[model samples]
Target: MNYKRLLFCLFTGFTVATSPAFAFQELQPSDDYIQVSKEIVEILEGTHYNKPSINDQISELAFEDYLDALDPTKSFFLQNDINALSVYKKRFDDAIKSGDTQVAYTIYNLYLKRVEERLTDLENNLSAMLEGFDYTLDESLDLDSEHYTWAKNKQEQDETWRKRLKNRALTLKLNGETPEAISEVLTSRFKNQLKRIHQTDAVDVYQIFVNSITAALDPHSSYFAPRASETFNINMSLSLEGIGAVLQMEDDYTKVVRLIPGGPASAKGELSPNDKIVGVAQEGKEMINVVGMRLDDVVDMIRGERGTTVTLEIIPSKGTGQTSKRIKIVREKVKLEDQSAKKEIVEVTRGDDTYKVGVIELPTFYSDFAAQQAGDKNYKSSTKDTKKLIEELRKEGIVALILDLRNNGGGSLQEANSLTGLFIPSGPTVQIQDQNGRITPLGDRDPKIAYSGPLAVLTNRMSASASEIVAGALQDYGRALILGGQTFGKGTVQALQEVDKGQLKITQAKFYRVSGETTQHKGVVPDIIFPSVFDTEKVGESSLDRPLPWDKIHETRYPIYWDMPSLFPILEPRHQARMAKDPDFIALNDQIAEFRENEDKYKTLSLNENTRIQINEETEKRELDRENARRAALGLEAIESVDDIEPTDKLVYSKEAAEILLDFIAINQLAEREKAQQEQAN
Candidate 1:
């Protein structure tokens, strides 16, 4: 049941020794790292599906990716530094082949020098400007500088830092912070950032360089340092006693990328993917701002013994302005019991006839393979738990079902196959194409139908891997109505290889649906698409560089239980009409539109306090109006303002999904009746 095709959980650790400021020195790569680099190159060249050559072209790509990894925003490094390092752009492959990392080390040393220069400038400039900084200047700071040109000189870099600091101060000012408090926070954040940069050891730089090379091959392939590999194992096993959240460094912010089901954070349901963690506080302690802090250091701050409370200052992924909130969560082990399949029945009334639909919300396609292998009869698995839940729901007289796969990032490939088997007569479910041009068809050998009633699979952008397999299979067989947004297009298979004290996750295969379409870049498209706040331009596999392109092979024949294509014309108009009148869906679409507008407008922030405040007020008003409208539609009291609204953990999309399922049930039943009558006439 190994779901090797899913996203690989990997991380790397580094030494964090205290160092004196401005103590710039050369960092030498360990002999082991050099050897591992060679091994990694050999393995990737031999085993990777892309079969990329380590020529000047790849060397150039690796060099650019490496630079981007080091300074994504192009904030620290100057144009001179980039020009100086351009000589090594075509020499990385040569350096790798010779097992001599002098070029990489030299480039990293230069980056360190730039960082030291910037830190010194920030300390001096901010300390002098804090006394009489102008807050009413008509200026704007471009937050997204990914494509911005590097600073031409030290003077230009200083101006960049000035604007950045001004924006920081303006944000705090807008949040009702005093000038003195804002100054203190900015100083501390800058100092901590300097310390983190100083703590970057040789191993950290080596890992980044190696990852850059692998990333140039394919986005999925990566190199994990020894400590990172250990962390990866802990995350995969979900055995770590912490908040049960996966964190990554996005610019200087530690972003929450995934929330493990049954974990403290997931149970709270307030924290979401893409939310930035700015501060972390232990119980009864002052909050420490984590902005510009090392990601591993932030993780250490958040992880502690079970039952101990950790408070996080989170900047939500949605909305506009510098809005933030504090969430207190008690750390605990993520229980598998919480992740197991859960069932509920949504009662839908149409014309005085109530249709009860069973909803099986799957958090992950999990399987306790270790327990099963150890002969534990009660080994929990997604397919097994779902089958039991279906049986229970059947006994309750449920007429239809919704397999909720929203936010399910997939696990256990065998479970996906078996889960698909529950609805369709057994056949090939997914096809895997390896580096050697061999296609292997994996299927459910058993022909048992677990549930044959009207079915719909609900998914979102976060739904991926094994979830995609099940959804795609059902869609291919016309067995279930696919609902929600396009899934996370992660169709590549990775195999973990142990090297000298490290691990390399190389993309070795690609997954294709039974109908021959690969889900690499374009994920499974639902029959009825929903409006999502997730920006696909920034979120999916297609958004990433060097991703494998979508293609198709010969289709694996499978029986079509329901002709969804023929039914789409009859069903889509009805579904659209219902959504047009659905208050929740209408609110969702409005929210999405507002979110997109805010995102577009806030890419660059105005430094003028009046303009910034005006923008913030407008955003707040819009959000408040949207919330009140939704409340009114749901038969709840409307709030006066956004501040009056209480935060709740309810997922709005999930409720909308239940309504869609109701429509699906009605349409399916009517279609069945029509088919029967036509058969009688025939």
Candidate 2:
């Protein structure tokens, strides 16, 4: 597993990337809140519905995802209860349709009342229990096998995490590092972590209880206390006045999952991913121990005035038993641009001809929903910018297009559909199903097909949602051949419905191909499945906390004009043959395997100079292998020896998979030939 996959497999204490545990068992929801939230849901389902407005639906879906995040076994209430209680959903829909929560407050009040009741119940029930209950149950669930492996609750999650750190700390301590140096890193985090539990255990319990009731309704609706619900909105595009980084609660430490590189924390150059912070302080002040404080409270301190400096004392998590040290940095504002798509070109040569293939690396399918809603033509999205890029590439006479969507966590549905339309004739793009089991067809609005020649989609275990839509549609219509690992299996569509004070992000429907097969759990199987360096078990929906199961529907009849067979037969063999001689590909596989073997070696590291020298030597050797592999792949000459290295300030190679440019060039030759034949006949 690469860093991304390892980061996922181990979660924060096995957090699985950007989220804390979603499913916690033994929840006792506020019955009254459930009753009211249910009533509101019913109202939104009926007369209050207006095609599920964006902001409203976002609020709802966000709330829903949070609710689902609470159930440990992903079994909140009994299945029978869900079936029987679904009757009130339409009432909630009606209330939503009544326009604005103020007017619809009647239905909102119902949901609110239930939430309030649940809160009262939690206050009463938890008072009796005191320490809170462990919610994870050992039930067999095949939905997401990974969930079963997650550490349950804060206690389980934190204790296991603390031990891991403690073990690493002991390793460092034994290495002869001063106790004060090690203390500078782990001791504060440990104490702060404990203090957090002592203070906010009740908050987590309340979150669990409320989420339980909301999750039972559907994975979308829930009650939010003022702070948490606010945080949820920020997670789902809540324009909050703070640094833009998604922090996950790990035992007692909050781990930085997705860092907006241009944002305050990332830009501060003080904090980096996998770097654990033990002490945080404002400028000119003494560093404070925040170890045992609740994540939210820590967050409150971390997030503050724009341009104001807050120092974060951190230890980089390069590997385990690596000496944990301290460094401090300031915070600033992080915007979406820090995580958007970038464009470049890859040169491929087959036989005597060279083809310049334009590659668009979309890290994520992000859109300025706020700007678009306000009718801002200046709003940013993948469709608009990529269109501009295509025109530029066309001017350069590029032979083909490679859309790279690996590791994209998906974004706006509207933009994803629009993006697909850029490649195909305007038509229905994806189909969605609601809670009522009614299917709604979403389509491409534009009629123009952008570039129609040879196109290839690059994906992996991380490409998801909107990215999946583009790849799946292209595959279904024969517009493009998908290459690399399987795309992320997030075919479910979520809508956030805004409530009075919070929102519910609910899994309103599942997506279907032009052929009506949903990519939910199965993801998009590539036309060419590469021997991915990725450990499939370690990423995508499989790695999520409470992801839904894979399902399918009757097929749709949308047809394509391209022949998939001609390309596949030749393309597959050519790719396989290329990899055989590809030294870079070979080295990558070896590197991945070796890392897996030594994944736990960090614990054995001693701070002794000899041990440190050995580790650094190994790191350098691995880097040398990687650099040599990259040098060979890019048509560059190989190093004469391991020591004959190209000097660089940093690691030159990125973890992204190299596109099969050779296969694409070969495929294009076939396509160009077909086009010529049609012209001659005409």
Highest TM-score scorer: 1
Error of 1 at 463 (Å): 0.3
Please give, for residues 38-67, the per-residue lDDT of candidate 2 as tens digits: 444554444221233324434444344333
Give the distance in Å from residue 275's predicted Cα in candidate 2 to where it truly belongs.
7.7
How high is the lDDT of residue 22 in model 2? 21
Q: What is the C-alpha RMSD of each candidate to the true structure, in Å?
A: 6.6, 12.8
Worst 10 residues of 2 by lDDT: 648-657
At residue 287, candidate 2 shows an lDDT of 66
Candidate 1 lDDT over 1-682, as tens digits, reads 1121111111111112343445766677678766777887799889999887787988999999999888877888888778767867898888777677767877787678778877777777776766656877798888775547789997887787788788777777777788888878887887887788878888888888888788788888888888778878787778889999989887778988878877899888778888999999999986788987877789889989999999998888875545577889999988888899999987777787877878899999888988999999999999999999999999999878889998898888999999999998779999999998899999998888889988889988888899999999999999988988899999999999999868888999999999999988899999988777778887778877888999999999888887777767766777677768877767777877777766767677788888877877888888788888878888998888775765431244455556666666667788789999999999
**lDDT winner:** 1
Model 1 TM-score? 0.93
TM-score of 2: 0.66
Which portions of model 1 show Cα errors greater than 4 Å?
Answer: 1-21, 640-682
